[model samples]
Target: MTPPITYDGRHLLADLYGCPLLGDAALIERALRDAADRAGATIIGLHLHHFGEGHGVTGVALLAESHMSIHTWPEHGYAAIDIFLCGARHDPDAALQSLSDHLAPTRIVRHLIRRGEAP
Candidate 1:
């Protein structure tokens, strides 16, 4: 008998602090794209939402493997991030680590999920 194949998906929930209010949207989006590229995931599209008056932005990057997304509230000193990827050569954990390191969140809550079924 043959064993089923599986892929790893990591979901991260983070509480960020001391993040820059203005111009952080582009920085985060860029970091995500870089991480995706390092993980061997192809970037499809990215959308960023900027709120007025230092509120922050919500950014989402769609990848060929899956997606990486983030929502920020600089005023409250918080951010929520999620990264999901499914493929043979993609490493979702590396992507998650890259984001965490870039953001430098003071408090972090992370979860890992293994997805898909046997062939």
Candidate 2:
């Protein structure tokens, strides 16, 4: 079997632990935008939704290369971020760093998966 050529890309799973400002949807949006910018990714559109005050926030940035998503739990002081960008033009690690800088998580854990890899 062979993998499709179009499947090539980088996917980053970022876990922000002991983070703050998870309830701030506006900040999260800004962070996402900054992350995309830092990664040199083009944003076609973006959307953010806040569950409620003192609750969680969900945000997604639609990029030309792919997408970046964030789900926050303010009560738990945690945020889960996923950044998947296609092609080699974008740096998903920079996006993750941007998110960490904006949110200032006490601890961060991340994994990068290379897409389109043959089994």
Candidate 3:
């Protein structure tokens, strides 16, 4: 059977404020993984980076559908998250919600956009 046509993908960019997530590398990685699962995206690989003491953490989860990345500023109680997934099987919005729930941010600014159209 022929596969259905795939069009643009969903991309969610979020800014989190007053987050309790304080530069924990492992937690960030886990959050990304959980978000990917919530979005129904397949995780291919994960990479995490830890900065100096009291700096922050950065992590990226490479998914079969697309990718999810996060950077935290614990001192500022802020985090930046990007979740992009291709195809209709996955929902970036769900991932965003899951991440937000995990982080428990007091203020959230979210932007959803469509990326890349069908050829």
**TM-score per model over all chains:** 0.77, 0.93, 0.90
RMSD of 1: 3.4
For model 2, residues 1-119, the per-residue Cα lDDT tens digits are 75556666999998999987899988998999999999999999999999998999999999999999999999999999999998787899999999999999999999999998756
Candidate 3 lDDT tens digits, 6-76: 57698999999998865888778778889999999999999999997888998889999989999999999
Off by over 4 Å in 3: 1-6
Estimate, for each residue in 1-119, the C-alpha lDDT of model 1 and write its tens digit. Answer: 86765545544444455554424777777778877877788999999988866787888889888888888888776777777777657877687677767776666666666666543
Better model by TM-score, 1 or 2? 2
Model number with the top TM-score:
2
Ranking by lDDT: 2, 3, 1
Off by over 4 Å in 1: 1-23, 117-119
Cα RMSDs of all predictions? 3.4, 1.7, 3.5
List the global CA lDDT of all models.
0.73, 0.93, 0.89
Worst 10 residues of 3 by lDDT: 1-10
Which candidate ranks first by lDDT, i.e. highest? Answer: 2
